[model samples]
Target: MGDLSGRTALVTGASRGIGRAIAERLAADGARVAVHYGGNEAAAKETVAAIGEERAFAVRADLSTPDAVDTLFARLDEEFDGLDILVNNAAIATSSDFENTTSEEFERIFTVNVQAPFFITQRALSRLRDGGRIVNISSGVTRIAMPEIITYSMTKGALDTFSRTLAQQLGPRGITVNTVAPGIIDTDVNASWLRGNPEAEAAAAARAALGRVGRPEDVADVVAFIASDDARWITADWIDVTGGSDL
Candidate 1:
């Protein structure tokens, strides 16, 4: 664990899956976390309870909406005197064949995956203390370009670029931004495939050098490193957390 006793962090998509794991990881390191969830208030509260209310709080914000982001930060500011870590982990996607992919579907994924993180960082900059860390959750699909989830891959690819560029822009401010791209993970988002479809899960697992699907904690560990002082020299870099699948 790193020394983060006085730091405060905001983690989006914290109601479940990788986001919840990241929030827990940060809290374990002693940072007070604002657990942001788009839906499922009960699940979000459960995350806070697991991490302890003294170290984590449940916050709700619909990232797909333009105005709700600012509203989210406004509440975060009211709770923490200064924000030290900003984790843009909130994202959404739907499975569809290329011909079946609709403009609405693509737009929805991009809005929440790309636009939300960009704007949320912009909106929350005022509260991000100097030397703070901003870690964006990306996907291995950007590198492997998964065929089934093409649109989702596109959104994550954009995030990799945004992480690099934003790091340069925030360099002068002493804030560092980086992206952590994870491979197929065993989470509720993927529970159907892992639980009911053994054949599908095995095929997915074969792609990873680890010989298994990733766990939420696997990705969370990488995010924690990027947010740590050990990575102070790293900026504008996209660190792959995909269990050697990209290789």
Candidate 2:
């Protein structure tokens, strides 16, 4: 059996991008996964099809909504007897001057990026076995301190802090919590504009000392290992999985 054989995992924002990649990797490693999406049901089903019905399940919930958060875990409770891992990967970006940003925008981003994960972890902790794992998908933009992406980076920075404190809290129970920060990943989030845009692509690629943009699998590999027994002793660690990106 693989390291994750027979394990049950829930991955948020799993319709595509890094979240989808994480779901596929865990499934390939033998874990039965619950692929969660906010609104893109079709894309979510596509992910399930790729994983096969036997190894993958699909669930929908807007992470920013309180009711959705509640319903999501309730469904988890109904469908599975236990959960072994959680990959909190759902988030959104709002670009604007600090003064122009709306209160609603702040709430929207924070609710999904920080609040949902907070409550989800709270609600799902009991179902997680003692040896369970939690990996929060954070970003490296906080280090670069980009002005345009300030709010998004702030949310991720909060996630890093959450991983630290939560790991310590869950450590006694043998559940390891950690954060994986990825740099510029080449994904569909901005596929329409980013592709063939030489100036933008080159700018992003230049950030990495490795001199290349990242792939979703790059971050997924880090998450997979963190959820394995090999990382049992690793907790409260905020790991930078960036491709040597500019800091």
Candidate 3:
């Protein structure tokens, strides 16, 4: 419903899962998309193919490294001189109890999930044109509090703060910053247990008021709106794509 013709967007971790869906959606809306991948060149190429290589290209960078972050921007500058929309959707999840989480694990997750995005946005400020949109793909765990991924949740909480603060900081430039938190999505990550297992699938579906597990497209649609000019007034907020879970 939103038009993005002639615009340019970047979607991190877009090789597969929700990120891939977001890339496809933006491309559908007529924005040239750059699909960022950590190390999956094959998957990235596949996504580009799905969106049409002429309209989509793949960029690779290990977000956990600061140098890699710089490299990513450098490559983006070469691929597209300016960016109209940025979706920070790349993240890693780890399951560890409060008593058992290791220092290394904590740092690794934060580096990839939190630190990278923090700097990525910082560096992107120059490349991001005025009136651009910044959409961070946060997680619903921030509100629901699943201890298994407490660290992951904490990272998203920090990202939420970043979004709110950046929204205000960049308002003068007409840039809108927001976060999209998705619930249990039926992606490859969840297919291991949520697919073909009626009991597991039913249990997951019961968690949402919609009585069904979410798909990547559900979140992608919302992101597409936030990226469009239509959502110019919506910022500094978190759009919960949780199917009303725990509500």
Candidate 4:
């Protein structure tokens, strides 16, 4: 754990999955975490309870709406004196190929996955303390093509570019910006098809050199490192947390 006793962090989509793990890890490291959730207030409260209510709080805002994204930060401003870490982990995935995808589906995914983060970071800059950190959650789909999730891959590709450019822009402010890309993970997102089905799970695991699907904690640990002082010199890079998948 890094020395983050006095730091304050906002973790979007922190009510479940990788986001939940990241929020919990940050709190465990001593940073007061703001667990943001779009609709699951109960789940968000559960995360706060796990972190200790005194050290964590839950905030709600629909990231798909631009106005709601603004409202999220406004609420954060009221609770925190200043922001030290911003984790843009909230995203929506669409399982559709070129022929099957619809315009509305693509727009919805991009709105939440790409547009929200861009605006959130822009608004957060004024409140972000110098020497702070920004971590964006990306995916391995950008590197290994998955036609079923083509739109999802495109959103992450745009996010990767955002991270690199933001790192350059924030360098003068002493803030480090980076992206963490994860491969197949045994999260709720894949539980339907990746769990229970031993054959399917095995095939997914075989894609990684480690011969296993990842856990939320696996990616969370990497985010923790990037947010620490040890990674002060590392910025504008994609930290692949894929267990060497497709490599």
lDDT of each: 0.88, 0.88, 0.92, 0.93
Tens digits of per-residue lDDT for model 4, 156-215:
999999999999999998999999999998988888998999999999999999999999
How many backbone overlaps does candidate 2 show? 0
Q: Put down candidate 2 lDDT per residue, 150-207, tens digits, no spaces.
A: 7788899999999999988888889999999888888998676677899888987888
Cand. 1 Cα-lDDT: 0.88
Lowest summed lDDT window (length 10), candidate 4: 64-73
- Mark the regions of model 1 whose C-alpha exceeds 4 Å error after superposition: none
What is the RMSD, in Å, between candidate 2 and the native fold over all Cα? 1.4
- lDDT (tens digit, per residue) of candidate 1 on 1-247: 7777888999999989999999999999889999999989999989999999989898888988878787797788789887999999999955576878999998899999999998998888888999999999988888896788888888899999999999999999889999898888989988876867989888878888878888999998888888889889989887777778857
* Candidate with more favorable, higher TM-score: 1 or 4: 4
Model 4 spans > 4 angstroms off: none
Of candidates 3 and 1, the better by lDDT = 3
Off by over 4 Å in 3: none
Error of 4 at 205 (Å): 0.5
Q: What is the TM-score of each candidate against the true structure?
A: 0.96, 0.96, 0.98, 0.98
- Better-scoring candidate (TM-score), 1 or 3: 3
Clashes of 3: 0
The TM-score of candidate 2 is 0.96
